[model samples]
Target: MSTLDQSRYLATPIPGPRSQELIDRKAAAVSRGIGNTMPVYAARAFGGIVEDVDGNRLIDLGSGIAVTTIGNSSPRVVDAVRRQAAEFTHTCFMITPYEGYVAVAEHLNRLTPGTGEKRSALFNSGSEAVENAIKIARSYTGKSAVVSFDHAYHGRTNLTMALTAKSMPYKHGFGPFAPEIYRAPLSYPFRDGEFGKEIATDGALAAKRALTVIDKQVGADNLAAVLIEPIQGEGGFIVPADGFLPALQGWCRDNNVVFIADEVQTGFARTGAMFACEHEGIEPDLIVTAKGIADGLPLSAVTGRAEIMDAPHVSGLGGTYGGNPIACAAALATIETIEADGLVERAREIETLMKDRLGRLQAEDDRIGDVRGRGAMIAMEFVKPGTLEPDAELTRALCAGCHAAGVIVLSCGTFGNVVRFLPPLTISDDLLVEGLDVLELVLKDL
Candidate 1:
């Protein structure tokens, strides 16, 4: 619906009658376990705007948590899905293979951060890719221990819950988690206090600190892999210290522990590069990618060194609908659109625009503890005006205010005091600034 107006419009109050009715239905029919960030219900989305069921055109700063980098219902992706579904929806790649799956794999193998021979296996979601990556790492290294960092957000599965660091919603009572998953300290420049300044300059110090713990607690011989998000998503868009990643990769290489970059949130040009690892010039032995891979389709891949990826035996690394033909076609079109539209560079432009605006806001607002992140994945951590103590109240208030004003924003951070922005790369500069304007007004009112 290119003819559809792609700008913000408010036809009714936030969560008007229709939306509230739907919400009532959802409350009765849906599981309470699934949480919602907004009271508004999406009816249609295009470009930078999500038209809610109440006909309120809200600016989409969350991009479905960076899933719609190419924008919601992208033309190329839609066309590809339509063609693929008409021909064949699913035949189960493992049972009866198809070229779309192979093409998608080739694209991932070539796009993911790395050089030399690489292999790829697709899955339905980020959790599946991560679980399989762990399986492959263990198969290759013959180790049982995996190193996950603090402020990390992996997924919801049992094994991923063990790999993830947050409690409360993610891990609270979901205990008895998978064994052998160890947690390490991350190079959080904003929250590390004294070490924050040190790590900013020499991130290796932070890396060394975590490495020492791993070496002492979980010996290198027993370590299968070190999993981390280059630029964490749900865990507050925390970008690790500059040299921190290289040091970790080096140690993993030295100790023969597989280095896996969980780029699920930072992949596919979301971080101004094809992958966030490129910013550090670090080529992870294995990289897990999803989210923005196929526009908005469910697709994920674990692409890595050929030797490591091929370690698993036949039929050991796939799912029934892992590389469904429809998803693969969408992925191919998504890549083509990314390349043809130059969305990678567009992500860089969005970065410059957002950081410039938010940098000005942060300078005047002491409550904004820190402003950090790369590309469209930027975040502002909120804290007490004069101290480092997190201000979760203000964070929640700001998000609520934005939502009421028809701007879709999301919050994160271990303390729930970070407001993150993940607007689609296709958003026009005017629409983005309008969204930011709402945020500024909301913050001031708060």
Candidate 2:
């Protein structure tokens, strides 16, 4: 048997004794608006496992919403962060530009999907990166209309919310959104209904539909850019058809529309490629990336053509906390770690392993409506057997079961029926497979 740690508290259930004490304190002291998935409190995490305050060791499949792709407490990242902190933590880049920040930007310009005269500006979050991308697009194109796809999750900021599609939680009670943002259909093959077979054609159709809307409603001349998640993240990890992205890129090129690939969740080898757009042979005009950028530091960036990135007036794009030195150091170290450890190849290995396990589960159970994703960023959509209808209840149950079995899993999707797995790329194969086995057992119960 694999010697992976499967320690479970025989004393009490998870949120056991010590964690429950923390939860009680949290409910009284902290904001109730923020939700807890498993009601477990973490003490520390490394590689794939998060040891909660209760001393329950749970395999981390979520990777803290895919932020810690390299791993939790990676030696290089930790040391870099510590060293940077020792030197200085907060010398705002705008006030005094630092070498680490400049290095990170340069690295991003080189690493992001595009080649040829690229530039990058770092920000604090995915939303900020996205906001800057739009700013650049609008400033460069001299347009007001920005188009995004349905079921897309850009971020929580006002402009991003306007760009986002899901109405319930994202848009609910936050109306009077930013103007000139338009919504288009994403290629959700599993839920395409009538349009499933023509996904390629549908991509063109979605573009044409948006173009028609722009022509009639917003006007092509008034449109700034069309931003899309290369692999739609919180929106169900929807991978578009083979020709879809390329066709959309063609449309954008022909129409003079800036094609923005939101690599916030798919960048940094979380997907098989360094960037998801690379999978489709696409070189987007602007690429927004965050999430996995700096291991766990709050860093993000927009890298694009030099002319466009420089279009905005000097001092137009920046924030007080944007590209803090510590985060920059973490980012530099993360990049070095990715290359030095060959995490990109590791991501591919993870994809194969996950697909093999999840595919087998899918084959055995029809509740798994769809088992789809690229690389380690895999997800399975649960649905009522023989139907496309979402089974969020079963998804919840599966996640709970996995947690009980000492594995942490996360549920996503507009309908909350998807269980996405984003284990640290540095996770041991033994631990990863154990987590998969636990998940399989959970699914069987479901």
Candidate 3:
């Protein structure tokens, strides 16, 4: 028997009664800083569907912002979480290390794409992981400068906020950011009107331009790390043209700079391989990960070559709740599920499905300007017909229409004009097709 459920709701309208009550209370009680992505209040979720308090069932395409790649409430993950909680939950790894934490680290070191003497460190969120990676890189190289790119969304912490390039809400009013952090151009082939070209030539030119900026501003000798998201998450799921990662890796190596891949959104088999960098056969000096590592648990990690990581002093790295036992256990189980169930291959299958369906939509509608991304981390860009200008208005309308039609999709990009898809790898084909159908209907209106 299949372990799945697909019962649609009988309710007339979403956020019918109970959800509205919670929304009213929440708005009054909670800080507005905590943004709401969807109107419906989640009561429960399983497989690929979320049930709201109002008894409305909707297909979840965002997967809690790409954190639940293996699906919510998987038997292995739930049992592991329950068992660990029952035994013991809090024992700071710093005070007394545990087996689960070490095991998870071992797994990360072995799995992350790189052939070197590897070591790993754990943290609470993507932001924490990124910050710690910077610390390690600086300590190792004795350098002061870090470089990022335009439209990148690193995190909300002060340091990451400075590293991040977006403004308003993320960076606005939070400045006089950390010194020694800089920004460069991203290889947005589509926006540059260079799509359908050889990925090597297009991507190499972009990387060369960034190298020029680094040499002129920071001087390669002053740089500690060049941090990049192999596949940018908040920046429109922007997959750099092919050859971009390899070219950047070469530049970093030549300049004696540590290359850091922020794999927080693209790791754990969310892409076809275990890591997005694998697609290019490139190895980063440091790899930062989170999100799908522990099936919703608050866990993140920094794995890389041991020399750089160990350069920090004896007590240079650690946190009180860095590797909570429950999260460690969940991570162990999540990795097991990914291996045993062949979810990496499953992610590739999702890519094929999305391309076939979204490609058809683009063929029919001029607003569907671009369909891009790899594996299950997919996105589409909306543009005015026969023009390169972004149509953020159309993107918002499409997202709103999808929400009303019982599909939850997310809009991203510096201009807020790209719809990114991050459905769970285990999402059933029937439901996935239904969600895509709903998205197509919305595009029809546009």
Q: Give the clashing pairs for model 2.
A: 214-219
Candidate 2 local lDDT, 1-446, one digit each (tens): 12324443323587698888888999899997678888888877877777777667788889999999998877899899989999998978889788998899889888887668999999999998999999999999988899888789999899999988888777899888999898766667788755556643466655554456556766667788989998988888888766667877887788778999999999999997888898878999999999899999899999999998999999998999999999999999999999999999999999999998889988989988888999999999998999988999998988888887778888889999999999889888888898888888777765
Give the poorly placed runs of model 3, Cα more than 4 Å off: 1-4, 194-201
Q: Could you arrange the candidates by TM-score from highest to lowest?
A: 1, 3, 2
**Superposed Cα deviation of residue 215, candidate 3 (Å):** 1.0
Worst ten-residue run, lDDT, model 2? 1-10
Q: For model 2, what is the error of residue 106's alpha carbon versus the real structure, in angstroms, after optimal superposition?
A: 0.9
Across 1-446, the per-residue lDDT of candidate 3 in tens digits comes to 12435645537476578888998999999998888878889878888888887778889899898898998887799999999999999989988788999999999999998889999999999999999999999999999899999889999999999998879669888788889999988888787554545532478877887788888998889999999999999988888877778888998998889999999999999988999999999999999999999999999999999998899999899999998999999999999999999999999999999999999888988877889899999999988898878999999999998988788899998888899999999898998999998888777876
lDDT of 2: 0.86
Candidate 1 to native Cα RMSD, angstroms: 0.9
- Weakest 10 consecutive residues, lDDT, candidate 3? 1-10
lDDT against the true structure, per candidate, is 0.92, 0.86, 0.89
Assess candidate 3 and give its TM-score to the true structure: 0.97
Error of 1 at 425 (Å): 0.1
Q: In model 2, what lDDT does residue 201 have?
A: 43
